[model samples]
Target: MISSTPTTVTDRDFATEVLSANQPVLVYFWASWCGPCRLMSPILDKLAAEYGDHLKIVKMEVDPNPESVAVYQVEGVPAFRLFKAGEVVESSEGAISQQKLQSLIAPHLAAPN
Candidate 1:
């Protein structure tokens, strides 16, 4: 099991937790029935634990949170969106390698402030 304490985001909590976050936020848009989403869950959990302080990893169930999906234009499951200072800086869809995920997040990790 993944040991990271990933925040579960919903329609009610999206703006406060993600858009208004002080630190960078990694939002994973997923659905329970999506196979790839299930596969990436463990990896996301690991990332959350490893980068707990510098980043906030959140998981949103697309079916229940359509507003977020519409706002972010999430067309598929297992979508990953990185937000910095309340704006979406990067996004990815479908399955992705752990290395790619790390690479995409490297810049935010390197931000001085």
Candidate 2:
């Protein structure tokens, strides 16, 4: 059995967990039927653990969270929304490689002074 830290978000918690999070949060919008979404899960889990301090990774199933699905204007599965300061600053759709995901979050990591 594998344990993961990425909080599985629901429509009810989206506002507080993703939108109002103090740090950057990566909201992974996916569904059970989406093969690509399944493929990206482990990568996200790994990234979440490694960047836990700087980023918060969460997943919300569109099928069950229709409200949030419509709110985000997500048209595709395996969609990603990067929220900073309560707003979406970056996003991607479809299956994305780990390298691409890393690049997306790398800039948000702390810069040594």
Return the TM-score for each candidate structure: 0.92, 0.91
lDDT (tens digit, per residue) of candidate 1 on 1-113: 33257899999989999999888899999999999988898888888888887888999999989988999999998999999999999999998988899899989875545
Which candidate number maximizes lDDT? Answer: 1
Q: Scored by CA lDDT, what does every candidate get?
A: 0.89, 0.86
Give lDDT tens digits, candidate 2, residues 22-45: 888889999999999889999988
Q: What's the number of clashes in each of the models? A: 0, 0
Q: Model 1 — TM-score against the truth? A: 0.92
Q: What local lDDT does model 2 show for residue 76?
A: 98
Worst 10 residues of 2 by lDDT: 1-10
